[model samples]
Target chain A: MQFTCAKEDLLTAIGTVNRAASKMQKTILECILFSCGETGITLRATDIALSIKTEMNAQVEQTGDAAIPAKLLYEIIGRFPESDVTFKSVGENSMEISCLNSKVVLQQMDADEFPIFPALEDKEQIKLPQCVLRTMINQTLFAAAVNEDKPILTGLLFDIEPGSLTVVALDGYRMAVRRQAAISDIARKCVIPSRTLREVSRIISDTEENVKISISGNMALFEAGNTEIYTRLLEGEYINYKNLLPADCATSVKVETNMLKDSLERASILAREGNNNVVKFEISEKNLEITSNSEMGNIDEQIPVITEGKDLVIAFNAKYVLDVLKNVEESEVLMQYNTGVSPCVVKQENSDAYEYLILPVQLREE
Target chain B: MQFTCAKEDLLTAIGTVNRAASKMQKTILECILFSCGETGITLRATDIALSIKTEMNAQVEQTGDAAIPAKLLYEIIGRFPESDVTFKSVGENSMEISCLNSKVVLQQMDADEFPIFPALEDKEQIKLPQCVLRTMINQTLFAAAVNEDKPILTGLLFDIEPGSLTVVALDGYRMAVRRQAAISDIARKCVIPSRTLREVSRIISDTEENVKISISGNMALFEAGNTEIYTRLLEGEYINYKNLLPADCATSVKVETNMLKDSLERASILAREGNNNVVKFEISEKNLEITSNSEMGNIDEQIPVITEGKDLVIAFNAKYVLDVLKNVEESEVLMQYNTGVSPCVVKQENSDAYEYLILPVQLREE
Candidate 1:
């Protein structure tokens, strides 16, 4: 096998598949297949749960294939000069890499031992703008359960409807729901692991092109630019979170998102030291006060707000509220809730496209 | 304790003492004593090994001292607005801090429980440019022994003479010597722990002001910018490294430092996998060849060089050579060796202000 490519192009291709290869067993499993054929060079790596493959432009001298150690190949490519790097197979299972006047011979694994990448044929397909998909993933993935005790909760529910696509995730403490326009009108539902969504989103962020997703019975493939990523779907029954959200809220406060976020961040620093990072908010017609007391100290901050309905006092885990607040870019946010025992709903001032529900913690008066 | 100061000023003062307070015990030693008096505000912290203190201008309403947790104080002050912050003692062990509409009451330790910083005074002192002193420390400190197995090797020897000061450190495999003009006429010798020198260098780098060094008995103090740091000297007999350096050299090669450095870095990648990270260099009339072969692979790199004395081949730890090469800013570096078994001397082409000695490993030809 012999091929030459720009140092930067090879480096980027290696980095694209590095995450998938890192989790694979080093014995042949961690080897990335470098196939030099008619068009260019194709590289693939997999960790059973996920696989990524990328096609890069290169000058192919001889058409052949070899499996190189993913990590070592990346490190070596990273140090090559900003010129074309030539990779040529020498004797059996040995390869030589050259750039400018520098040359090195590295050992390679048997290409036969490497796993083949799956063909990403679409049984059902969905296409969306990369930026929009990435935003949807970011808004809801954080609410997914971190621990896999409940496998279903560790994934974000993809509820595809006739005209809209709704992504939702929930842990025991909070829930996040995001809705966006759908590219395809076919209605279907699937549970994709939060980790997979994060990886897909990360790949999509690198470019502004639309991502074409192909889903079969068990695996989903994401194709963006010259790269393709495949991840296994989580199989389980997801909880119906609609019943958990309260229908009526007695109190509603409209405050600038930045103002509320800043105050809560400072108050959370003190609350973080407590058993449960709970910060209490007292809302009235004119102003809102946030307070938290922990072993280290206490913080009391007040931000002006326009109130509606009834005056109320409620407490919540500062982290849950902060998570959703940071994702919001709007100027004002509406905080609506009933009695201290009900869930607090946070949404953009005039939009219902995104909703964050935080469960209130029972506060004991000292 | 009651005082008011700009948020930036207080944060800077706290940061100056943070390094010293972090090493102290958290129960009591971690507390930084905050003193508000007629003059201004004084803050101090100590870890027995090192102590730091700084004084800044602040409006004092009460003359009292309170020992506050160094980490907590810094964290809280970091979040305060850019306005003046008011700190007042509410009780014997609690203090209230307010800035704008934000307020918090934090617990403080008993002032009497905190360690008092020692007064640093010496009849003989040295004042040097912070940049020069920082450079001297960086060049020699890396050779200091990391473990205290041999306590003497852990400290860098500071040999101060009438007109010149020489600093040296050796870790069995290598030695680094740096010589510079003395800023003070009074000559005295001392051995400072490498860790102390690193900390002193770090503080010096934060400012462009001069650094004042004072040594008395077993303690040395470094005053840089607005911070004064005290450290206990490492008292012991240093190894006689002068006898280990070779006076005769049979082979020499002058090459671009950057070229040699880059080639060696790549070759070292393969060598690092072996039991010894040894890279062999062969010098000829116009070219130098570097090679390394390990279990993973082998790398051979060649670069142009100007040969002097006798052409020879030798092997040394690639890391040791890379360390000194990175410190050289000159275009070319001179590499000299007497024999394959003797130490190789590396220095700038025309300067003797700093010299690096690397011991070569006995290579067996296969």
Candidate 2:
């Protein structure tokens, strides 16, 4: 294949797709297959788990395919002269790249060795504004399980209806769920891997354009401006997170998000030394007190808050509270607790919007 | 000890000294001992390999001593309000810190359990400009051995005479040595651990004022401004780097530092796939050509330069050459080489101020 394209466009596309390429992998999986034709040149990469296919318009003189090492190709293309770069396949396993006065001959692998990506059928597709989905993913994905020990927890549950879309993630320790007005009429639910959500968020530009998403059985496809991202779904049932959240909380308090976050972070340093990074929160009629103690020492912080109901004392992993506070959108966050042993719920003061539920750690007797 | 000091000052002092604390030791060697009295507060830490002591002027109420985890103390103190913070020993193993409306009591190790650092004895000391020593250390220390397999190579060699000072470091593969005009009349030689040199560089500010450096039997002490750094000297002799550098070379070429660096960096992406990241440089009367090839591909870059010798082709580890070029001072660098297998010498074009010798890697047969 022979074609010429802008250096920056190719660099970005290659970099985005190469993220899934394993550095230690010695096979063709580390190679990004490039196809050039009269229309344009397309770059594809997959580890048999997730695949990214990107097409960039280029001046095509010949049609061919070559698989180049993802990392080397990206680096070389990034460093090439800030002008149009021409690529031409010279032999079965080599391609010539020329730009300005510099030329490089890159070794290539057989494109046929690359795994065949399933064609995304034009079935049930949901269209959503990029920014809305991006925000929802960012707000809840952090609570997803990082390891596959409990495979279902590693995926975020996407529950969609006619008017609203809800995304929930839980690692058994903490759960985050966010709801947004739906832009599509389709009603469906699927568990998309947290990693796929993160990658989709990263690859999607800040443009206001809509991203078209399609789910077929166990595979999902996301199509944006010029990029297509495909990820496989986890085959398991997600836990009923709503059942875990307390229906009636004994005490609830509204405090400034930033102030509460700062106080909790300072106490976390002490709390982190213990078995579970436990920190105690004592809520009174008009004040919220946070405390943590270890063999190193103890920290006590008090923040003025508007509170209702009886006084209560609860202990939890300080990190969990900080994470919830960090993602809260409103200036004031409302914290609700039933008993010391039950899960505590945190959300923006008066909205049924985004909510976080965190299990408390039993306080150790002094 | 009881005292109140600005949170910023306390945090800075703790951070500087915390570099000396090691987590490997079972004893609370990772803790920084704080002594607060009526005059000021002193923070000190040591792992027996290196020691750092810093004094911060504070409002002292009563004298007290406590050993707190260096990292935790720094983190906690850093988060305290920018205003003055109060410190009071709550009991034998805990200290209370109050700033703004925040109060934290840190558990401390017994002061008696902390290591007793050796006194900075008034010995034969050499005074040198802080920037000069700092630059020399940065230039050569990157070449020091990281593994303990070669003990002596892990330290930076200090060679001093009546009016000159030279620092050298090598990891058997590549060596760098920097020389400066000494401001002191004393002549001495010692080997300080590379890690200690790095820490001292971080703490020492760039100042025109001379820093007093004293060498004892097995310790090196550096006192500058308000900080005192002590490092244990490595036992055994350093390699004679002068012998490794060739006195006479068959070919020599001068090239702009940045031009060569950029070209080498571009070639590095291709070279990285090779066994040793070997990049070949062919110097002729008109140009400097850099090339690297692996199973992945090959890259050739031609940079214009002025040469005074016959055409020659030499190959060396691209990373080594990049490291040497990165630290050279002059705008133009002079490269001298005899053959493809011989060591390549790199230095400033017109001066013998700093020299680098990088062993060439043997070229694989095509």
Candidate 3:
């Protein structure tokens, strides 16, 4: 294979695909497959479960393929000055890369050893603006279960209807849900591994460009610009999160987002020193009192809020409350509480575009 | 004890003195002594070996002292909004910190338990612009030994004369020397621990204001602005690095510092894959060819240069060469070399303010 391209184009393509390259020891999966054709050069890397492919324009002298170690190639290409870089097959087992005054000959793995990108047939497709998808992922991905004890919980649930899409992620203590208007050809619900969504989020631009998403059987594909990511769906039914959200509450309070977030963050500092990051909130007629205590210290913070119905006291792991508050962009949010031990629901004052449910920790009788 | 100060003032004082707070388990040294006086509040912390003291203005209602955990106080003060924060001792064992509508009661250790700062008597003092001292430290600190096997090498040598000050740091492979002219009452030499220098560097401003440094017996004190740092000197005779630099050379090359640095960095990427990061340089009449090969790959890079005297070939650990290149601020530097196995010297073209000596690796005969 022989080709020449702008250094930036190659570097971007390499960076995008290299995220999926396997880091396991002694495996050909550590290589990125470089395929050159008459039109462009395509770079692909995979770790069996997740695969990424990207294409960039290059002047082709001959069409060929080479599988090169992803990290080595990235380091070398990243250091080259702004210039055109050329790659040519030196032999069956090696490739020569030259840019300006620098030249490198790197050994290549057999291209046939690379795992082929899985094919998805008769897939249902949906389209959404990239920025909308980016926001939805950011708001929910943090709530996903980080441990693999239950594999399905480690994936985000993507529920699509004809005219809207809702993404949900939950650990045992809290659930995050985000909804946006998106058109879909067919209704589908799939649990995509959170790792894949994270990679997709990093690759996609936060612009108004549309990202094409397709799902079939046990596979999902995300295509943005010149890059495509393929990931295997977690093969298990997601929890019935819709039924878990509390529909009614005994009390409700409206508070400014930033004020509440700041108070909770300060209270969290001392709470974190305890075994459980527990912070208590006392809701009353004109203010919300947040308090937390550890072996070393205790904190008390008060922020103005408008409350309706009966006053109540509740406690929760400060991290869960802080996470939801950080993602809420609205000026104020309405928090509905049922009791001290039941889950509390937080929503935007004007719209239901985003919702968060957090289970309160049982406060020790005091 | 009671005092009120701007949150920023207290936070800055805590950050400056907290660097000396000990991190060892179950120790009172982890606390910073907060001494309130009629005029201001003085914060001091010590780990027996190094101590730091800083003072900030505050309104003192009553004069007393409290020893609070450095990290906890920092976190609390940093999170407070821009307002006056008040600290009042709640009892003999705790203090109440309040700002705006928030209040925290933090447990405190007895102020008497904190280590006292060491006293230095009959000290010789010298003063230099903070920016000059900052630059000199930056240029030579990287060459200091990180291991404690030779404790003196882990410290930087400060050699002072009536009108000149030279700082030297070496870890056997390379030595960095920086010299500047200043007026001093007494000529003295001392080895200040690198850790102390690093903290001093961080706390001092990069401005034209003077920094007063005093040395006596085995103690050195650095006073910059409102902060004062005291450190015990590393006890041992420093190696005579003056004899290590070659007096004359058989060849000399003048090259652009940035160009050489970039080429070396790129070549080092491949060279690093080998055991020793070995890169060979073949200097001819017009160009310098750098080459390195590992089990996985090989790279060859060439850059133009003006060579004087005999043409030569040499090999070195790329890291040492890169370190010197990264520190030199000159547009062009002259590299003086003897035989391939001898030490090479790099210096600014116009002055002897900075000097770097790097020993070349013995290349195996091919």
Candidate 4:
């Protein structure tokens, strides 16, 4: 095939698809299969688990397919001329790329060597704005289990109802859940690998375009603009996350997000000396005190808060609280605790858009 | 001991000294011992191989010494207020630090457990400008071997002449040598470990002030600013690098540095597909052809050059050429080679400040 395309357009499309290319010992999977036809040139890469296919329009003359080394081809094309570049198939296993006064002959593999990407059945589909899904994934993905001991907990659980969709992830120690109004007519529940969610978030733009999501029994497909991403569903049962969150909290307090962030970060310096980097929060009528002690020393910070309840002191992993606080987009954050030993719930002061539940560490009695 | 110092100052000092601190299983070496007295506060850390000691002026109330955890103390101090912070030794193994409205008590170890820094004799010493030493180190250190398989190659060879000082480093594969004529003192030659050279470089500032360097037996001491850095020299015979560089070359070429850099970087993307990232250069009357061929593909680039010889071609590792080009401070670079298989010499067009010698890779006869 022969076609001319902008360097930047091809670079961006290849970059997105290259993320799915395997960097392991599998040589065949490391290549990006290129297909050029009258419509455009399509780049496809997969690791047998996740696949990405993106198409960009170009001046086409003939139809052909060539599989080039994904990383090297991307790097070379990225540094090539700023003007349009032409790609023409030379023979059975090679293609010539010319831009400006420079030309490169790239060795290729047969397109048939590329694994076939799974196609999702159109029966189960959901439509949602790109930003909505991106936001939900960001809020909950960090809480997913990194260890594969429990495979299901390594994925983000999606629960879809008639008008609301909730994304939840829990690592047994902590949990994050984000609920938003559904923008699709389909109601379904599925678990997506946290890594897939992260990759999708990186590729999805913040534009107002709606992304179409299709799912089969074991595969999930996300299509937006001229790009389509497919990932295999994690097969297992997710934990009952609702039961992990407290039903009612006895002590509640509201504080400025920035103020709490600064105080907690300072306390973290001392907390990091310990095994779990534990930091204690003591909520009083009008102030919130954060404290951490280690062999190096102890750090104590007092921040003003709006609270009207009995004084309570609780301890938790400082990193967990900081993660939730950094993800919440609000001026003030509300923290609720049932007791010193139970889990604490953190959310935006006046909204239930995103919530984080952290299990407190058992503290030694003074 | 007790004193109050600014958090910013403490953090900067700790960061500088912490570079020499070891994170290995040797716990005593990981601690930075602080001695507070009527004069000032002295912080010291040593890993037996190297030692760094600095004195910071502070408001000392009492005289005492304590060994504090380097990483933990640095982290805590870094996050404290930029304002003056009070540090007072409490009990036997604890210290309290107060800054603004926040206060932390850090557990400390016995100062007696800290090792004593090596002593330097007054007889053996060399005084040189800090800027000159820093420049010479930067130019030659990158060529030093990182692996300890050949301990001698892992150190920079120091050659001292009547009015000139030369530093050379080679990993047997590539070699870099730099010379400066500012020094007029007679000295012997020695080999200093690349790691020690790197640490000394980080601590030394580019100023007009002279730094005292003392080398006696197996240890080298550098006294600059308010800090004194001591490193154990490597004991081994260094290769005579002067014999490796050709005295006169037949074919020579001069090219613009920026243009060469761009061409090399572009060609490197394709060259990296090969085993050694080798690129071939064909030098003609008015043009230089750069090419790389691998199973992935072949790339060809033509750049204009000023040549004074018959047509000649040579192949070299792209990474070695790129490293030398990046480090050399010149607008135009001069390249001299005897033949396609001989060592190539790279330097500034007219200056003798620095020179890079790269061994050519044997190409297959086609």
- Native-to-model Cα distance after best TM-score fit, residue A84 in candidate 1, in Å: 0.4
Backbone clash pairs for candidate 2 read: A296-B107, A297-B107, B1-B64
Q: List each candidate's DockQ score.
A: 0.68, 0.68, 0.81, 0.58
Off by over 4 Å in 3: none
- Pairs in steric clash, model 4: A107-B296, A295-B107, A296-B106, A296-B107, A297-B105, A297-B106, A298-B105
Identify the CAPRI category of the predicted complex in candidate 1: medium
Docking class of 4: medium
| TM-score for each predicted model, relative to the true structure | 0.95, 0.95, 0.98, 0.92
lDDT of 2 by residue, B223-341 (tens): 98888998889999777777887889888898889888877888888778755688888889989888888777788888888888779988888999999888877788988888888
- Candidate 4 error regions (>4 Å): A24-28, A100-102, A113-128, A215-218, A236-244, A262-274, A293-301, A364-366, B123-129, B206-218, B265-274
lDDT of 2 at A268: 88
lDDT per residue (tens digit) for residues B13-68 in model 4? 88878877778633767889888878888889888888999988887888888887
TM-score of chain B of each: 0.94, 0.96, 0.97, 0.96
* lDDT (CA) per prediction: 0.85, 0.85, 0.91, 0.84
* Per-candidate RMSD, Å: 2.1, 2.3, 1.3, 2.9
* Candidate 1 chain B: worst-modelled 10 consecutive residues by lDDT: B19-28
Question: Per-residue lDDT tens digits of candidate 1, residues B1-366?
Answer: 788889999998888787778644457778888888987998898888888888989998888988888887788889877899999999668999998878989888889877767775555687777888888899999888888789978988888776677889889889999988767777788889887887788767644567888888888888887678888988788877677767877888889998898998888888888637899998899999999988778988989998888888899889999999888668888898898888999987667788899999979878
